[model samples]
Target: MWLTNARVFDATGAAARDGRAILIEDGLIAAEDQAGAVPDGVDVIDLAGRTVLPGLIDAHAHVFATPPTPDDGAEPLWPGLTAHFVATGLREALRMGFTTLRDVGSYGDEVITARQAMRYGAFPGPRLLTCGRIVSATAPGGRFFDGMYREADGPDEVRKAVREQVRRGADFVKVMSTGARSVELEDPHPAQLTGPEIAALVDEAHRLGYRVAAHAEGLAGTELAIRLGADTIEHGMYLNQRPDLLDEMAAAGQVLVPTLSCYYGVASGQWTAPLVRLARHNLAEASRTLLAARAAGVPIALGHDWQPFSDAAVELIRLVEHGMTTHEALLAATATGARALGLDDRLGTIQSGKVADLTVVDGDPLTDPVLLRDRAQIWLVLQRGAPVAGAVFDNSAAIAANARTAADSRSVTHTSALSNAGRPRSGTTETPG
Candidate 1:
């Protein structure tokens, strides 16, 4: 299959190239060639000069239902219902142009089950990589987060916890190196685990050939995780307070997933005053940390640790607003994210021999990254050379009819096909609402 006449952004932190075409065979990118160099008898899908990008990746997300609030007076959903919500959330993520999601935490084993379901083709969804449950020390967070935390203490216990997650089919391991801001009983500043415990956890995970994603918020814990060789730091918002750690991360090739959207969510919501205050403070510090990390050459990846799977693109816009360039932000969501998840060799950029997962947008995202947040602007999404979701698939009947009529007139055009696909074009260059 040939995807022709498109502006291709290979997600190499570079500008888009015009009049390019991609060749796909057996679910892999075969080659890249000039748009006008297609051989005869090849199936072609013209993009009408639209922007094509590597499929986006979210490195830190939760697929389970959010824990209930005390004021809501509702019990947690049943296990089966939780699984259903996980499935729906994953499917929604795929429709929004995300081809891969790395879930750092989820309730029980629902993430593993959802991964199995998607792998078996029970439903169409993005590729899933999960950490079965968050490994936390004995703390108030275990009670606050319910089934999401796998509480353990001591070096031996933490090592066992890592093995347990491996046994549960986890693609990676997540360890809480510090307390959480959301739980009022817990403080976000101090380290939650002892040095030996965290060391054992990271060592065990690495020994097993699995990457460890450390949930870090405070400077003390952030330094520990960085020094202990955590593969990725989940939320190193206070890293600005410790530039030395950022330097170490840059040297060690550790990726930082700032998760800026989660702090924004908490600060803007009707949460308790203290939690909101902490969130606002962390949000500001995170902005400074982002700039410092960039200066230190620390790799940053996009991770929307918020709800509503469809709004994942908001992280890209947020990254740009914080300090990164639009091209840098796009790379954060694509190449850098894949690197964070240890899948860069197979899934990040658009190059020969990589997996054929691509997203087609109606306008240039470098001009206005906000267009990625609009569902209507997602022209087409392909996963492994197969059309999975997007405006094109949603309006296939109309597109087919228009193609037939255009063929009769001998004036078929990709623009007419897009018009029939019901894509909204007027707001493609608009700013965020």
Candidate 2:
């Protein structure tokens, strides 16, 4: 498949050629050049004045569990992961042009299921790397009952916990280096993991051949993870507040995945009162941290730690609004994120041998950064040379149809329910008032 006549913008910036074409063969970008360079027999797709880019990547998420966690109490495990919900979320992600995502945690086995399905093509989704769960301290504010949390007091337990997650099929290991207001479910200000404990987990994870993404939010946690050589710092929201920690991270060249969307849920009043209060302090800290990280020369990647894929993509735009240049934010979602997941060899930027995960939008994202968030302008989302999920967004009706389909499905679900069991059946369907 070849896409031609569109603007192409990526890590290299935006460029327009009269009739340039991107030929995709065997899921890798085979050739990109002037039109008809690949021969007439090849499938040619024309993008009328749209902008094309590498398919986006989300670095952090709870892909298997959309709602994040349920209101379960004292359970070692949260509700299990279902193939259905994971697949649906992946579908939504792929439809939105995300060709790859990294799940920071999963409830039960859902994320693993989704990852396997996508890898095997049973379900269409972005390429996935998954962390089974975020291991935390026993009394840590972020502990989630019995679900994925494996409580550890010291280095010994932390090391064992990492192994357990790997045994459970985790693609990578996530160690909650600090307690944050968000996951506490109660406590907003939490304690940081000891350096030794964090180092233990990191050492074990590396030995097992998995990259480590530390849930390092507070100053101490961020510093500990960076000093110990953890792969990436997830949600270094308070690293800016602690100049020493920021400098250390910068000096060490640690990558930062600032998940602004996590605070978005709290500040947006989407969470309960306690979580909201926790988010209140976090929001400002996170904003400041992002700019600081950028200034300190810390690598910043786009990781929508939010539940669904759309929210993650929005974080890409938010990164720009905060401090990142359009080019920087795009690189975060593509090259930076791919690097964080240790998949840079395959995914991320556009290159001759890289997978042809590409997206075609209507305008240059760098010039008008808002174009990155314009779902309607996304004319095409291709994975491995195939048009997957919803049709290209360039077709106005396709966009409207997709939107209407969502609304109609929702309307039917909420307003089209049958009469109550004991009540008389109504001849007409009751609509949402």
What lDDT would candidate 1 get against the real structure?
Answer: 0.83
Query: On residues 269-370, what C-alpha lDDT tens digit does candidate 1 reach at each position?
Result: 678887789889989999999999999999999999866798999998889989999999999999999999999988889999998889988888889899
Residue-level error in angstroms, candidate 1, position 315? 0.6
TM-score of 2: 0.81
User: Can you write out model 2's per-residue Cα lDDT over 192-220, one digit (the tens) per residue?
Assistant: 56778888888989998888988876666
Clashes of each: 0, 8
User: Which 10 consecutive residues of model 1 have the lowest summed lDDT?
Assistant: 424-433
TM-score of each: 0.90, 0.81
Candidate lDDT (C-alpha), each: 0.83, 0.69
